[model samples]
Target: MGEVRVVAVDVGSVRTGSFAWAAVDVPAGGPGLCGYGSDPASAVASAAEALAAGRRAVLALEAPMSVPVPQEWEQLGKGRAGEGNRAWSASAGAGALGTGLVQGAWMLSELGRAVPGLTVTTQAGRWTGGDARLLLVEAFVSGAGKPVATVLGQHAADAEAAARAVADRLGGEAGTDVVCAPHRAFNLLAAQAMWAGLEIGADELETDVLVVRARPVST
Candidate 1:
C-alpha cells in the first residue's frame, strides 16, 4: 500500500556477468544501479540490501517460474529457422528451449535466500505480447546518444532495463509511472565508459531525472 523498493534482476545461466541489478523507490522517485556481478545472485542480495534501506522490496525476474515441458518447449521454439523437417524442427525447438530454461530453479532459489517475502514474477507481466523482449531491448537501445556507463560490466544495462519494467508495473497501482533514465542518469552512475554511443557527457542527473510524469491517475 505504501512505498516498496522495486528491483529487477536479470538472471544469467553462465558463471560470469550472470546478473544485473536496477532499482527505484516506490510511490516516490529515485533509481539505483547495481551494475553486473559474476555472482549475480549475491550481487542482487547486496543491491537489495543497499536500496531497500529498511523497507520492503519487490523483485521482478526475467525467468519462467516453471520450466517448459518437452512439448511445451517445441511449441515455444516452433517456427524458428533451421527446422529442416517437421520432426527435426520440433526436436531442435525442444533443445533450444531446454537450454535456455536451464537452472532457472537454482537462480530462483538463490534469490529466495536473499530477500524474504520479496514479491517475484516473470518479465512477461510487464508487456503486452510476443515483442515484449524487443520493447525492453528498444528501451535500452533507445538510450543511444545519452550519457550512460556500466560500473559492473557489459550486461548491467539489461538489469536496469528490467528494473524499470518492474517499477512501471508495481508502481502503476501507486500512481507511479516509469520511464527511461535520462542520459545524465547513467553519467557518473558507472565507472569509465565501456559502452559507446550512449554517453550524454554529464556527471549527474539533473531535474530531468529521465522519468517524467505524463498523465494524471485515472480514478
Candidate 2:
C-alpha cells in the first residue's frame, strides 16, 4: 500500500482564535512530525489542493468528530463508548466538539468546493485507493488519568500527540478500519457540509468521525 499523509489539528476556542496543527508526511515510517503551525484554514486548503493534484491523506481532528447516543437514551448526553470518564459532553470535550462541528464542517465544505471530484471517506480502502481522497478521523489526545504533557506547548503538543497516535495505529493495521466507525451513522459535520452545498460521498456503514487514541501500553 502507498503512504497516506497525516494532518492532525489541535483545535482551539473559536473566540480565542488559538489553534495548532502537525503534519506527518510518512505516517508508517517514523511517523515524524514534518509540519506544525497555527493556520488551520491554510493547512486545510493546502491538503485539498494536494488531493486535487493526486495525493491521499488523512485529516485528523483533535476534537469530538462524532457524538454517540445511547441506544435507549432519548438524547445525546453521555460520552461515547470506550471514552471512559472523559465524557464528550463535559469540559474540554464539549467545547472541542462544538468547535469541531463548525471547523470540521467548514473544512469539508471547502474541500468539496475546491476539488471537483474529491471523495472523502472514513474507510481506509477508498481513501488509500488508486485515486486521491481524504480520510477524516477524530483524535483523542488525552483523557481521564493520563493527561498529555505540554512538553511542546499545549496545543502544538496535542497536535503532535494526535499525529503520532494515528500514525502508530496506521502502522499496525493499514487496511483495517482503525478509526472508521462501524455501522452507518450520521455525522453532524457532514450534515452541516451538505447544508453548505457540499455533496460528501460516504459508505452506508461509515461516518467521518471515528475516534483514534494511542495504543495502550503494556503494564
Candidate 3:
C-alpha cells in the first residue's frame, strides 16, 4: 500500500465498552471520525468504509494482547516475564489482563481475519502508563488545549488519543523513543511500530475534530 490509514480502537471486554476512529483524510488539517462506535466489529466496519484498502494501514488497540480467561488476569499479578508493565501495575491486574486476553485478543484475531493487511498492536506492553485516565487527560489538553472527553466521551477520547499518539510517532519522531520519568514505555508503541503507517490529519478535508497539534505523550 502506498498510503496508510491510522485507526485507533479502545475495545472493552464484555460490557465494559469498545470504540474506534480512523484519522482519514489526514494532512489538510484534522481528520474526521471514520469508525466511531461501541462494538468492535461494527466500529471496524465503519472505519473500513471510510478507509481505503489500497493504502497501508495499522490498527492500534489499547487492549490486552492475550488472556486465556477472565480470572487469569488476577493470577498474572504485576506480571510474568513480558506480560506485565513495570511502569504501572495496571497491566498486571485481572481486569486489564482479562479484557486483553478475552476482548483484546478476540478483537485482534477478528480484525486480522476481517481486514486484509491490517496491522494491529496491543497497547498493554511496557508502553502505557499507570493511570490511563491521567495520561488521557494530558493527551487531550496538551493536544487540543482543552478537555476533549466532554465532547468525545471517555471511549472516543481514548481512541482519539491513541490515534494521535500513533500520528505523532510516525511523523518525525519515529526514530526516537518516547520515555518519561520512572522509565515508562510512554509513546514507545508508536515509535516501535514505525514500520506501520501513521499520518497527520487535515483541515481542508472534513473530519470529526479540527486539527489541533497532537504529539506523543508520556508521563
Top candidate, metric lDDT:
2
Order of models, best lDDT first? 2, 3, 1
lDDT of 1 by residue, 1-219 (tens): 345555554545465545455565556664444333445455456545743464555544443212212343435423312112422125533443343234333433454455443332122233222211111111121232112446665446565655655556544443222222221111111111112112222322221112212122234
TM-score of 2: 0.78
lDDT for each residue of candidate 3 in 71-172, tens digit (9 for 90 to 100): 334543233233223212353343443453344334444544555455423232211222110011111213232225736576667767666665555444
Residue-level error in angstroms, candidate 2, position 166: 1.4
Off by over 4 Å in 2: 14-17, 129-132, 144-152, 174-185, 196-199, 202-208, 215-219
Instruction: Show how many residue pairs clash in every candidate, following the order shown.
Output: 4, 0, 14
Task: Compute the lDDT for candidate 1.
Answer: 0.36
Per-residue lDDT tens digits for candidate 2, residues 48-111, read 6557656677888877766654455555465566676776778888888888777777777777
Model 2, residue pairs in steric clash: none
Question: What ranges in model 3 sit over 4 Å off?
Answer: 13-32, 46-52, 64-88, 91-94, 115-147, 175-219
Q: Which model is ahead, 2 or 3, in terms of lDDT?
A: 2
